[model samples]
Target chain A: MELAQRILVVIRFECRRGMILSRVATALVLAVFPLALVLLVRTQGGDLETGPRGPGILFALLPGLTCLMCLLLWAIPAIHSEVEGSTWPYLAVRPGGKSAVLLGKYLTAVAWTTAVGWLGVSLCAMTMRLSDRLETWCVLGILILLSALAYGALFVLLGVVFLRRAMVLAVGYAFIMEFLTGFIPAVIHRFTIQYHLRSLLSQWTGWTPASLGGAFHQLSLFSPWPAWGHLLALLGGTAALLAAAGCILRQRELIKPESE
Target chain B: MDGPAGTMILLEHVTKLYGTVIGVNDLTASLPQGAYGLVGPNGSGKSTLLNLLTGQLRPTLGRIAVLGQPPWNNARLCQRLGVCPEQDAFYPNITPLEWVRYLLELQGFSGSEASERAEAALEQVGLAETRRRPLGECSRGMRQRAKLAQALAHDPSLLILDEPFAAVDPLGRRRMVELIRRRIAEGKGVVIASHLLHEVEAVTDRFLLICGGRLLASGTAEEVYALLEELPKEVRLRADQPRRLARQLLETELADAVRLTGRDELVVSTDSPGRLYRQLPQLVDRAGVRVFELRAAEGSLQALFDALLRIHRGMKILQPRD
Candidate 1:
C-alpha cells in the first residue's frame, strides 16, 4: 500500500475508536472552544484585546500559546494514556510493515491543533476585525503544526525510552521544555519547539531574526531552503528521532523477567 | 496420531540472544504439527520458541520454518500461521466482532467472508454471547477466547500458541484443549507452550520438552517420558504385618530396592517385575502378611516427566560453574 494512503487510513481508523470519553472531549474541544473563545476573550481588555494593537491581531496570532498547549495538554499526556492502557503492542509492531504509527497520532494532534485550535484563533481574529492579517493567520496555524510534530516526537521518544515511567517524564518534559525554555537566551532558545515556533510567529509581528531569528539560525534548523527548509529539517530531525526509537523498541524486550 | 510424514515444525540451531544475555540458547528440535505440546518451565525459551515460530520474532542465529515456509517477515508464510500471544493487549472500546472482523480483513478476507468467519470463530471458541460486547468489558477468559477467535478466523494452517491456557478458568481450559484436539484430528499443526505437562498431555499427541534455554526431550509424550528410564519405578505395597514383611523383603535377594513408606506400606523399585511377581505369594506366606495395596505410586507419564525434570534441574544447578 502507498505510505500516505496507509497513514490516512490509520488516522481515520485509529483516532475514532480508542477512547470514548476522550473522543467526546476532543470533539468538545474542537467544536466548543473556537466558538467560546470568541465570545469570552473578545470583550476582555487585558492582553486579550488590541485596539491600539489593531483590535486583537496580536491576540489572534496568539495560538503560539498552543505551542505550550500542544506539549502539555496534547502530546505529553497522550502517550501516557495509550501506554497505560497498553496499546503500543498493537499500534507499534507489524512484520515488514512501516513503523510510522506516530504519523497517525501526530496527525490527530495536527488535526485538532491546526483545524480546531487555529479556528479558535481565527474566530477571535474575525470578532475583533483582525481577520485580514494573513501573515498572522498563516504563522499561527503553522507554528501550532510544528509544535505538534516537535513535541509529539519528543513525547513519543519518551514513551519508547522510559516505558515504565514515560508518563512521569513526559509531564516533566512538558513543563520544562514548554514553560522554562523561553527564559533561556541565545542558543538555548532554539532547542525548545516552543521557542522556535513562537520566534517564527513573532516574526510575523514584523520583528527581525536579530533576537528570535538569530537564535533560531544558530540551531541549523534553517538552511538555504528557508522556511520550508526549516520545516523539512524539523521533520527530518523528528524522523531520525523516531528511527532511534524504532531501534530501541525492536531491541528491547517489552516484557522483562522481573515483572513476569 | 499422525505419522512423521505429518511433521509440522522444524528448527535448526536456533539461538536467540538478547544482547550479550542468552534468551533461547542453541536449541534444535522438530515434530509433526498435530497438536504438539511444548512443556517447559519459566524462562525455558517456550515463549521465545513460539514467537520465533509465528513470525513475531526473528531467531538470532538459526533458521526456523513453520508449516514448510520461513516465518520471519514473510507475509505469505504468515497467512498460513496464527499466534495467540500471552500478552494482554487489545482494543478496549470495540467489540470482538469488530476487532476480529478487521483482523480477518487484514488477512485479505472479503467483507462478508470476514464477518462470517469472525462469527464462526467466536462461536467455536464459545464466546458467542459476549461477542458484541466491547472486549475491554469482557472477563479475562472471554478476552482470551476473543483472541483465540481471531487467530482461528483466518483458518491458519499452523497455529503457534504461547501459554494459551494461562489465566483461563478450568472450564475454558478444557474447552480450549478440546478445540485443539479437534484441530489435530483434522491433521492441522499446532504448537502450544505450557508450563503444565499433564494439562497438555491430553490435547497434544507429541511433546517438545525444553529446559533451561535448551531442548531437553522431544517426540510423543511417551517418548519424552521414556528419556527418564533411569529413574526408579515407585511400586507401593500395603500388607498386614508390614514391618515383618519389610524385614523379610530387606533380607530377600532383591531386598536392597525396598523402603518402608508407612506403618503398613512399602515402596519398592524393582529391576525385575518378574521375580517380584513370582516371589510375592511365597514372600507373603513366609512373612505371615496379607497383601493389600500394590501399585506404582506415580502414573507412568508423571514418573517419566518427573525423572527427566530432575535431570534437567541437576544440569541447571551445575551450569553456573561450567
Candidate 2:
C-alpha cells in the first residue's frame, strides 16, 4: 500500500478501536468535566465573566486544562501501548511501515483529542454565555488544535524515547514545563507550549486587562507575539518533534529480551 | 532479487551481541530452499537468529541476506518475508479477519485483495469458522493459529516461525505441523525454530542446532546424531531366546556392555552404533532369536544435547584466566 493508505488503515483501526462504549463514555465525561465546573460556578451565583482576564475560568478550563488532560491521556499511550503490548514487530516489518504506523497513531491521537477539545470548548462557551460565540469558538478552536498538535507530538516523542517511563516523564513534563514553567515571568516560560498558546489566546481575544491575579495577570506583562508567530512556532515545533521521533524509532530496537 | 545460486538464506560470520550477553556469536550458515528446523534451548538464540533472518534485528559484525538482500530496514525484501513471533499478541478488540486484512494491506495489497487473501489464509490455518471472532476472546490455540494466518496471509516467499509450538497442545501441534508441511509443499522456503526436539523432528529431517548463541551442528537427524560420536549410546532389545542373543553379541565384542533387564530384555551400550547395528541382525539370526522391538534407550536428540551441554560446561570450567 501507499504510505497514505497505510496511515489511513492505522487511523481507521485506532478510531474503530476507540469507539468502545466505555472509552467513549470516559472521553465524554472528561470533555464535560470543565463544562461542569462552569455550571457549578454559575450555580453558586457567580458570574461566568467575573474573572479578571481572557474567557474567565471557562477558557482556562477548556483550552488550558481540558485540552492538555485529554491529549495527555490519549496521545501518550498512542505508541507506547503498542510497543509495550508487543504489537510493534508485526507492523514494523512492512515496507515503509514504521513511519506509516507512527504517523497514523500520531494522527489518531490528534483527531481524538481535537474532537474532545472542540466539544468541551463549545459546551463551555454556550454555558458561559460568551457574547460573540463564533469568535470565541474560533479562537478557542485554533488554540485547541494547536494544543493537541504540540502536546500530541511531545507525548509521541516521549513514548518513543522513554518506552517504559513515557507516562511518568510526560506527566512530569506536562506538570512542570507546560503548567508551572509556562506561568513563570521569565524567558524560560516562553519555552512552554502554554506560553505560545496563551500568547495566541491573548492576541486573538483582545483581553488586555490592566491588573488581575498572580501569574495569570503577569502573563499580560509580556508583549503578545503576533498570532501568526505563535501559530508558526507551534506547528514548527510539532513537526520537528514528530520527525525526531521517527528518526529515533528507526534507530532504536523496540524489541526487549522479555518479548523474545 | 533472486537468492544466491541455490541458497535462500546466507549469513557470513554474523555476530550479534546485546551488551555483554551474546545473542548470536560469530557464525556463518547457508540454508537452501525447502524446509529446515532451527532447534535450540531457551535463551540459546533460536528467536534471535529468526529475528535476524526476518530483519527484525541486525547483526553486530557480519552480513546477512535473505533472497539476496540485507534484511535490516529493507522494505522491498520484507515484502518477501513473513514472521510468526512467539509472543501471543493481537490487535485488541478486533476480529481476526480485520487484523489479517490490515496486515496484508500494509504489504501493499488493496482492501479487497487483502480481504480475499486473509480469508484464504485463515481458512488454511483452520480459522475459517472463528475468523470473525475477536482475537481476545479466542483460546490460546486459536490465537496461535491467528498468528500463523497473518504471517501466511501475505504469502511471502519465505516464512520464518519462532517457537511455533510453544503453548500448543498435542492436537494443535499436529495441526500446525501439517500447516507447515503444506506451506513447504507449495514450494516456499520455511525456517521454523523450536526448543521442542520432537516438534522440529516431526516437521523436517534437516535441522540446525544452536547453543550458547553458536551453531553447534546442522544436518539431517541422522547426520547430527552422527556428531555425537564421542558419547555412548544405549539400545534396548526385547526378543525370544534373549540369552542366546546376548551370548552371541558378547562373543563378537559387538556389545560393549550388555545387561539383562528382564527375562527377555537386554540393554546394550556401545560407542560404535554402526558396528553394533551391523552385527545385531546377524547375531539374532544365528541364534534364532525372535526380536520383538529394538529402541533407543534415550531420545537421540535429547541425549546429544545433554552431552554437548556437558562438554560446553566443561570447557567453561577449564577456561584460562581472563
Best-performing candidate as measured by lDDT:
2
Candidate 2 per-residue lDDT, tens place, B1-322, comes to: 3446978888898998888878988878878887888888889888888888877788899998898888888989889988888888766688889888888988889899999999999898788999999988888888888888888888889988887776677877788889888889899998988888888888888888788888877777777566564357788999987788888888888878888999889998888776777677877887888999998766578776676677666543111112
List, residue by residue over A1-260, the lDDT tens digit for candidate 2.
Answer: 48899999889888987788887887798789977876777789876654443264555776678777777777777767877777887888888888888989899988888888889888876766776777788988888888889988999999888887888898899888877887677889877888888777667766544445454554543446777888888899999999999998887777765554
Candidate 1 lDDT over residue span A1-260, tens digit each: 54454455456555566347875566456534544654566557433333234322333334444433544445444444554554433333333222344455556665655555566556655655453456556665666566666666776677667866766776777667655765465466466665555445544554333433346445433222345555665677778766776566555445333211
Whole-structure CA lDDT of model 2: 0.81
TM-scores of all predicted structures: 0.76, 0.91
Given candidate 1, what's the lDDT at residue A154?
Answer: 73
The CA lDDT at A87 in model 2 is 81
Please give the range of 10 consecutive residues that has the lowest summed lDDT in model 2 chain B: B313-322
CAPRI quality band, candidate 1:
incorrect
In model 2, what is the error at residue B87, expressed in angstroms?
1.0
Candidate that scores best on DockQ: 2
lDDT of 2 at A60: 75
